[model samples]
Target: MDNRNMSDIIESYLKEILDQKNQIEIRRSEMADLFNCVPSQINYVINTRFTIHKGYKVESKRGGGGYIRILKINLLTSNDYLETMSEVIESDLTESEAHAILEQLYGNNLISAREFRLLVTIFDTKNLSTCEDLNKLRSQMMMGLLERLAYEELE
Candidate 1:
């Protein structure tokens, strides 16, 4: 299977388990064995899929008793979640980082499908090739777009 499929399977498995509990602790090697994949595959799934932007906090221990703990962060409100995301984007913004934020917002239902597509198109690196300072432009554009969307949601 492709890496994307493997990642999706791993992510789904973890999310399914997590649904039964607020937190889960698992050994990386054990999970790898269960999925018939390498330990790095588990790490890849955890790092990319279970990120802070996705409302997960991950902690790991090394050695014989090593375990990876995944905790779901519960944001009090949508505004609070948006505020937390805004803080995360504090200065510079990269293409991948911006895409992650957009994905998070869409996953949490904070943004609609149309909005997500529009934002994705606007922030696409290729679309912004005309800009001299890509990072700065991306940061400004994302910030402005987010602020406007937040305001619209408030109205």
Candidate 2:
């Protein structure tokens, strides 16, 4: 709707499709009819936008029940995931939320029992029982610890 070129539109659509992990099966004639362009225009857009170099695989059938299938390549770099998790935990977390995140890290084999115990020691509320206003402080500290670990993992 913003007057983007055909390739941009196709690229955006492909991203959405990949996010949903749903295969696209558009008939060439139907696509051409919807876009009010020749079928070759659709071919050009598909070739340019859904290429393997851009992390996609495409297949097409040519008969009466023919359709196009696009598969997205999932690239999960460890450093990237770690960096992203570090950025995600920059905000405060509730105790239960922090425990859940810690569980996830444990389940993913990202941290050992000693590290988990250390984190629990660092975030335990027993040490702060003397303070009357430490409700969210534990959560903040836990988030800070996780963020630091994630950042360290990126290095």
TM-score of 2: 0.44
RMSD of 1: 3.1
| Tens-digit lDDT track of model 1 for 1-155 | 45568789889989998988879999999999999999999999999888766778899999999999999766566676677766767567888878888887887788889989998898998999998888788888778867876787688
Considering every candidate listed, which one attains the maximal lDDT? 1
TM-score of each: 0.75, 0.44
State residue 110's C-alpha deviation in candidate 2, in Å.
17
CA lDDT scores, all candidates in order: 0.83, 0.63
lDDT of 2 by residue, 1-155 (tens): 59997667666765786789845667778877877778888888888666543345689999999988787644364344344444555345445545555654554556788887776565556766785555467656755655676677767
Q: Where is the poorest 10-residue window by lDDT in model 2?
A: 73-82
Give the clashing pairs for model 1.
none
Which residue pairs in candidate 2 collide? none
Best by TM-score: 1
